[model samples]
Target: MTVALMWEARAVTGRGEELLAWARAQELTPGPMRRETFRAPQDRVLVITWWDADYDAVLPELPDPGGELVSRAAHRWRFEPVPDPT
Candidate 1:
């Protein structure tokens, strides 16, 4: 099974681009099978990483860019794909 890790953060006012750049520069240790990033309207950045591991596995996450870049602490979540019935 594969697991997906999601990390999200909201940048401080007028600092969205800086935060996005910081997130884009991060390299996950051990790496992941796939990864992508997205931006929302309100200076929010979201990153999703896919890994060939179990849900309980310890995975490398994006570290804090800096206190000045983000408005608050980052949020993280782990998920496993639902099996197909076919």
Candidate 2:
């Protein structure tokens, strides 16, 4: 099965660039099949990683950038793609 992990964070005021750089620099051991990063209006950063594994399989995820770097704890979610009816 394929699993996609989503991680999102809001950086502290004025530190969006730093946070973005930090997130981009992170590396996951064994890594994912694909990974992407994004930013949004409230200085928020988002990362998504695709992996080949079971829904409940343990996988590497990005760690928090700590209180100083963000406004609060980062958010994470997992998903499995649904086949399109065509």
Candidate 2 worst ten-residue window by lDDT: 60-69
Give a tens-digit lDDT track for model 1, residues 1-86.
89999999999988998888999999988999999999998899999999999889888999877998999999999999998899
Clashing pairs in 2: none
**What lDDT, from 0 to 1, does candidate 2 have?**
0.96
Every candidate's lDDT: 0.92, 0.96
Per-residue alpha-carbon lDDT of model 2 for 1-86, expressed as tens digits?
A: 99999999999999999999999999999999999999998899999999999999999999999799999999999999999999
State TM-scores per candidate.
0.94, 0.97
Query: What's the residue-level lDDT of 70 in candidate 2?
Result: 99
lDDT of model 2, residue 66: 76
Model 2 spans > 4 angstroms off:
none
Shift in Å, residue 17, candidate 1 = 0.7
> Hey, what RMSD does candidate 1 come out at?
1.1
